[model samples]
Target: MVDYGQAVDRQADEINPATVDQRARRLLRADEPAAANAPDTHLLQALSLVLTEGASDLHISGGAPPSIRVDGALRPIAGWDRWSPEKVADALGSILTPAQRVEFDKELELDFAYTINGTRFRVNFYQQRNTVGGAFRLIPNEIKSLPELGIPASVARFAHLPRGLVLVTGPTGSGKSTTLAALVDLVNRTRADHIVTVEDPIEFIHDAKKSMISQREVGQDTHSFASALKHVLRQDPDVILIGELRDLETISVALTAAETGHLVFSTLHTQDTAQTIDRIIDVFPPHQQAQVRAQLAATLRGVLCQTLVRKIGGGRVVATEILVTTAAIANLVREGKTHQIASALQSGRTQGMHTMDQHLAELVDAGLITRQAAEEKAMDVEVLKQLVRRIDPTDTSVGDLSNGEIDFNDSFSPGRR
Candidate 1:
């Protein structure tokens, strides 16, 4: 019933970056209901646009038409109607359960998953200056394989490991869930193991193949992540996929699971391997820090930090920093010298360990992403510049290493663990 194309064309004119930000701020301040109530099919219409446009995310906020993010850029639908607080609430009632409304009212923020016409979405509902807003991420019906996602074969090696902790971390929207699901799917196809997963709200639904999967939603199937993790060992699970290691208690339990010979997969909001290690250790009390570090050192199997960037032509490319733990790296963790982990990664190339900069540079070399874009997301600007120069001989923006532009001894020191 909606003329989707006409609506998009009409609304596209009003979607300049400045106007988007201005309207967002204005809506945040006013936070009042308007004259019209949104029609019952408002939410469905927006979702329909997402599928038709192949967008990854949809953002609904007051004082603006529903906007979709495609290939990392937000674009407002052309003919969509702007939303008001009361209208937003009315539209939300169609998808939210009565109990969910109560929870949303109590906490002011809620997360859950919903299905629309066979496509699933990971939904987040929250308040913005007293107005209801929602962020919806489209979850594809079919889980993509590692090769399909452009992940290196080296990453698949971790999926085959029988024990220890393997982390896939990055900022939100970095495709962590996708990668985790792919790994779990790999195990499900090749091994006759029991896989148990604990998620806040299970995103991907896995079918039994070579393995049997038991997915426990944090609030629904279990009281909380900590509670489920506490009893998971008794579940006789061979491979455990924890949605996140959010707190000290959960982290401790995950570490324990890995130490006891369970191959545990988890995610963290970290940018690199060193930072991931630091975050876990910093979560514990000072007195327990040393012991936690040693435990992590002994159990950490690998870390893959990923980021999604706009590709040269279209879609998006994944850049990853992989850390496959070795004896030397384990000793470094035990010795409380995490800052030196970057150098270890540089020299551990044979072992598949590399920094974020290395991954970004590789993308630049392969022409999947532009050097400027890669450099912008790069961790070490100097190193990225050198890499880009090496790949592109004509690039003279940064002097060569022979011209005193870089000091390898200072940057890549082989300090003892």
Candidate 2:
């Protein structure tokens, strides 16, 4: 049996002063009270550490030093004492409003955004093991373009469509929100239309540029997604951005909006293109599914499914699968033959459609990420291997797709090709 506690200790030791950036080291060396006694101060310091270390999230819990997630791995911040449950609650609660506190007390969980020192974070406070814990996800100050984010340039075409539903799907923390923001920014810059976005806690802040933007948050600006979307059309919106298609009512209203000739953009916590189609249809009742499918086929423009994989040296890169709803794909959705969608993606490359494995294979061939990392994110490992082999027949790293094993020793390295 393995001793996981010791393993964690070893990992923690790896994050020493020498390994951290200069800013992080300076913050660590600052004179501050113990975390147990000064929870609020420690919380701010931890948030600052997140920025300095180039981490995506900061995690706070009892019996653990505040940790930040970098490149999909968690590392404890050096020089911080382990927090107690009361301290954890106090630190996180200090930032909440009185009304928010009441809501949190009642629901035992809360989701909100916080900004400190000009940096914004999407925060969540929840109960775990009968104690309060918090997660702070750093929101980038600037919204990156699709190409900068490694999204295919073809996806930008959806931004120009006069009407139809464009869904961005991925698991949690897969940069779905970021992609949606980029598309919205694209519209804001190039088009002279009214863009209305309904978000829960509103992650990105978009100012009016060439277009008019009306952003509504769930709790503050509106009651719920269904409620805000209920009257959005009356507001004269040419482009609608729904943060996530969370329920049947929201999904129904969004579909209606798209069908009514409004360009709609939203997100779903589904893994891939096929699964995204299935999830939308599955949300309605059995009797309503067929009609929903028909509506989806008529209004759905495209789906971009994305996931982040660890880069070769450090940081992360996005691997995406886009489905550009060709007539055949629309027919598949209408007929409920969602399984055939993947096949459609395989042949629809000319139409800007590609599978997740294909993009992962491309990333490996470009030496942006290792073969192992691509394999981990691949929907079908065998298919990914075959795609990689096809991309570079001389790539001795990828063994025969028929075999179960790969030659990792010969796999991709930076500039190896």
Candidate 3:
């Protein structure tokens, strides 16, 4: 087999020759301005610096000069001329090998991870109307803490349990993987058991501490998720982490992994708690719906419906609707009464459970986040208004709080979004 590390190093070497200063717009003084403008490997070197400086994402396109997103804002990198379509194509073509480009062409796009300056980037390179363009999201070297992320104490409770399934739900770029990494890190530090993670081009890197970790990346360490799931059972794993439950086969395998003495962690693209469950069950054929519901009812440990709400501190806070499957919740799920799970969560807070609205109300009360953000992300508005009501009964009137706005209420609605 060829060495990818060496191939990546070649790119690194190519980048170093240009000495693109990521912190500044200036290219190395030694390189000719005309050649640098033409497109070269040094762009990756410059990207390496931008990433090291904590830029959230980077974009290269046909009409625009290369741009980088730092702290959620777009800032133009100085010293670069307006890049034409040819320049954009040259920059992308220089890095993508002939084979990679062929594959990318066939797919109309490609998703892969590339490393430079020891920083890993989740890259999506593709064509746009016959023009080349790409975007890269920086993945940090260290896993951030849940508490550091201002994740509720209850969300952390998902990691403390030893078995069953925990699902993290959020929209794209909503910190789903980072949240999962925090939870996984929690287990890695506190538990003494075998943990296995199956991912496509694995994101977070975990160092073995109290727990042993086996990370399998698709197309590299394993051929597919189904095949890995087929063999992980004999590996004596105490926990199994699936990157995303994309297909029915993997979903079935994950539930089986949980049912047979293992704690399972996975993420899904869903807005709220109820929708998340619906999407999961919908993945299966109608013929097997009843059985899958029964299986989920018996083995679901929790479902953390979360979103990265803009916080008053200028970053973000995680307001999560956590569903810890209690006897009532399990019964509701088993009997095809998933809607009742929200009420169960609201009343079960003493047991470390909370609906999203409840959590949102708590954040607003604590002055951590605004109330407006809650209503906009809310799946059920009447319920959020009700929760605010309980916070202030005399102030029965409510206003929109979806855009970082807050207002108190007295009538607490049983809304689980």
Specify the highest-lDDT model's number.
Answer: 2
lDDT of 1 by residue, 222-249 (tens): 9888889989999999999999989999
lDDT, candidate 2, 296-334, per-residue tens: 999999999987777665556677899998888999999
Model 3, range 1-417, lDDT digits (tens) per residue? 111111121222234433444422332222311232323544665575453333557788888767766434566555455678897778766656555667777888876666543556677888888888888776666666776555656678888887899999888766778779889999999999899999876877899999999999875688778899889899899989999999999899989988987999999998777777878888999999889989998888888777756555444555677777778878787778877767777788687777778767666665555678777777677887777643552333322222232110000000111
TM-score to native of every candidate shown: 0.85, 0.86, 0.79
lDDT of 3 at 55: 51
Ranking by TM-score: 2, 1, 3
Better of 2 and 3 by TM-score: 2
Candidate 2 ranges with C-alpha deviation above 4 Å: 1-39, 390-417
The TM-score, computed over Cα atoms with residue i paired to residue i, of candidate 2 is 0.86
**Least accurate 10 contiguous residues by lDDT in model 3:** 407-416
Poorest lDDT segment (10 consecutive residues) of candidate 2: 408-417
Give me the overall lDDT of model 3. 0.69
**All candidates: CA RMSD in angstroms?**
10.0, 7.7, 9.4
lDDT of each: 0.76, 0.78, 0.69
